[model samples]
Target: MPIHSFLNYLALEKKYSQHTITAYLKDLNSFQEFCNNEFDKQRIIEANYAQIRSWIVALVNANISNRTINRKISSLKSFYKFLQKTKEIDSNPLAKHKALKVPKQVQVPFSEKEIRNAINLLDEEVDFESLRNRLIIELFYTTGMRRSELINLKLTNLDFANETVKVLGKRNKERYIPLLKPVQNSLKKYIEVRNEMNTNETYLFLTKKGKKIYNTLVYRVINNYFSSVSSKVKKSPHILRHSFATHLLNEGADLNSVKELLGHSSLASTQVYTHSSMGKLKEIYNQAHPRSKKN
Candidate 1:
């Protein structure tokens, strides 16, 4: 297999990030395993078109979602293209490959008042965990950071005087988001109680034992808090982010500015929040307009 050369190309020549490289390697490794099982072949360089087709069919057989399989197909296309460019293979098999179809997006987010109530519910509780939960909710709602960025946050990233926290976003890019005054006050209270816990961890959010918080723990905490506050909306960390973007859009913030704040790679990605705002506008229109209901 020319996997070595391709990996080197991705790492050094292409400069793909470690996370991306890992995903590519993982997909190739799965394909390698499939090749070994189906044709008693370990090296994929010897794989014929039929073998490649079998791998695609196998992914479908494994009940992988079309989106996931499509990503894997992309990895394969890149891998084989590397093989061909390096003169390891005669032809690029994945050039004609079809990706599995992915369904359209249908994300539903929370209303602004519902979000405030959710955070307020967390505020009513009286414990270190509760305080921390409140702080987490505030930070998510205020900053609109991704779950990974929130989990990766350290005490050092927060600047009390500057009123901002530097977040490391996707592709290892750095962005500073302004921390809201209310969120800052809650953080101060949380820190006071956190210090009382006497944990040795340097991370902002932590377990009772003093270890840094995991992504799942943060998700579950936010999920539980949101569920307690609102039965109508689906509560998740991403929803807080969605709520943030939607709220900003509703306030007549520039779309490009929101794109930069959210660290979106393109304006098209940020445009979805406009739809979120449009939905809110429709609700307002329905309540105020005489033609709204059958009454």
Candidate 2:
């Protein structure tokens, strides 16, 4: 089917991650199902804009958020674009479509003190899981990598001599992030315990059963540890990454450098973290500016 072809294009030509490709496939299949049920249309490739609009309206009535609905539409848009590229379709159905409005959300990052408290708590533990979990937190906070990048990290990705770790980021982009002393120490200890398992897994982080770590398991590791030290509503890997970027920016790191370090494709994507650094900027401005001296 054209759906399978489009998926192959995303995988082989576009070089999208498997996780992302799966999301796209799910969105496409959902649209196809909607077409079958509502319009008696078996083929989504033959669907018109009106049917697609009805799908959006249905999603809205079902209480799906605007952001999520937009994402589903975006998947269909890409599918039509792919069909156009391959000459299977002469016109794009979603070319004139405008995305639904989504509210801007500013994610609150963990305070530096909370991060340090969590780390200090883990520092007292001597077990394999504890050591691995500590390294997971440190890696997330220090390297600012996505959960997938950390889970996919292989043994050869580490370069202790150069103090850098090779990360395979989105769209199969590879970038090297320097490792801090604390993370290095944690890695050494974790690997020492990891060696006792005698598993042939090449991935850096693994389960007690010698298998690669899954997404929810990684989230649990972050959530369970931070629950003690943070009262924030969200405690996940992305928050740690946000905290990493915010803390660096707060300490006077350049925006462009942080962008490169975080593997952002554009400055616009990196600018979201700048909102959290405004307080630090205000403090610095008040201290350094030649304005008021008790005027």
Candidate 3:
């Protein structure tokens, strides 16, 4: 199928992660299914903007959010663009299409106190799983790496002597993150316990059965640990990463430095975490600003 060629282009040329490729495939398949059911059109490649508009209406009527509908349309737009590139379509159907407006989503990072409490809870247990979980949490908070990067982290990525970890970020880009003392200590302890497990897995994290850890399990570990301390609705690895970047900026880290640490190609992507540090900025302004110092 033509879609397979596009998927291969994404994988081989674009160098997208499997998780990302899978999401793209899912979105395309969803649109194909919609076209099949509504317009009896088996091939979504030939679908026009009018049919796509009907699908959007159906999605809205079915209670799907505008953000989700926009994402589906984005995938379709990319597909059509690919078709244009391959000479399958002369004119792009969604070349001039405008995306639906989506409300801004602000992700609240966990507070420093909450992070401390969560770590304290993890420190109570002495088992391999507990140590591994604590290390994962520390890695996220200290390194600011994504969950996917953490999961795919290899043992060879660690450079204890230099106190840096090599992280493979989006599009298979590699960046080295400096390791803090606490994180280094956690790694040492976790590795000691991990070695006793006798597993031959190359990945950094693993389950009790000595296999590599999955995405859901990493999320569950974060959620289950943080639920005891945080009252926030979202308590996952991404939140920990958010907390990491937010807290660093709050402590007066440079925006460009944070951007590099977070492996963001552009400052705009890293700028999202700056919002979480607004309270700290206000506090600093109140204390240091000459106007605020007057009685």
Candidate 4:
């Protein structure tokens, strides 16, 4: 019951995307079920730190990764914080809790040559699906939008006149991304085919049946194409996004500008891309610095 109210708060007041709201609800429900089965507790709001710790132990025993367990804990933290703020709870259970140590992962982005090869593989002949998929890949690499943002894109969001796209980012924040001429040309070609479908769906990308696209389909599109170009174990839409930021930074783009382009709420979030750009920086330094080159 309290969880329902908290979810409503997340949806209505916090304006969290549905995907995020679902993750929060899922994490909370898992904890709730754990409390009921293990501790005979009927309500999560009544749970304390010890009970929460027991759930963490159970998750660890079940072989769940620390990163995943930490995310579940974060969901609980936000829920309990909301409960406290609304006077439903006297004190927060996770007030003094520390997040589990997660090993930092180095995400290797696709090289520019790899990305270019993948784009070149696209058929020159214009077909609806082909054009749409090409546009999808181009948009991800160029704009650095989250997959969800691309999926939820409406036709109205495309500002052809200004060569910009209005993306609705996390927490319903809006940011405009400038579209390159090639991407704009691709969009024009895709639109010509899209209009022939005669469906009134406002969403920009659609399936063969003119239905709005889903996450799996988008992931499949990116994975299928990138599989041919790169041998990376993980190929997904986010990789293209990572490539977008990495490549931009590799070309001397400033951190703050990349931060705004990526629609990051803070500079810290944008700093992760710098790690991927380090190799480029090292190469440049070695080439330009005479002492380093001599050594």
The sequence of per-residue lDDT tens digits that candidate 3 reaches over residues 206-265 is 899999999999999999989999999999899999999999999999999999999999
User: What is candidate 2's TM-score against the reference?
Assistant: 0.71
Per-residue C-alpha lDDT of model 2 across residues 243-281, encoded as one tens digit per residue: 999999999999999999999999999999999999999
Runs in model 3 deviating more than 4 A are 1-65, 68-98
Model 3 clash pairs are none
Q: Count clashes in each candidate, considering only residues at least 3 apart in sequence or on different chains.
A: 0, 0, 0, 0
After superposition, candidate 1 runs with Cα above 4 Å error: 1-97, 231-234, 280-295
Whichever of 3 and 4 has more lDDT, that candidate is: 4
How high is each candidate's TM-score? Answer: 0.65, 0.71, 0.72, 0.70
Highest-lDDT candidate: 2
Evaluate all candidate structures by whole-model CA lDDT and list the values in order.
Answer: 0.84, 0.94, 0.92, 0.93
Q: List the residue pairs that clash in candidate 2.
A: none
- Which segments of model 4 are wrong by more than 4 Å? 1-99, 293-295
Give per-residue lDDT, candidate 2, residue 270.
95
Supply candidate 2's per-residue lDDT for 83: 99
Residue 258 error for model 1, in Å? 1.2
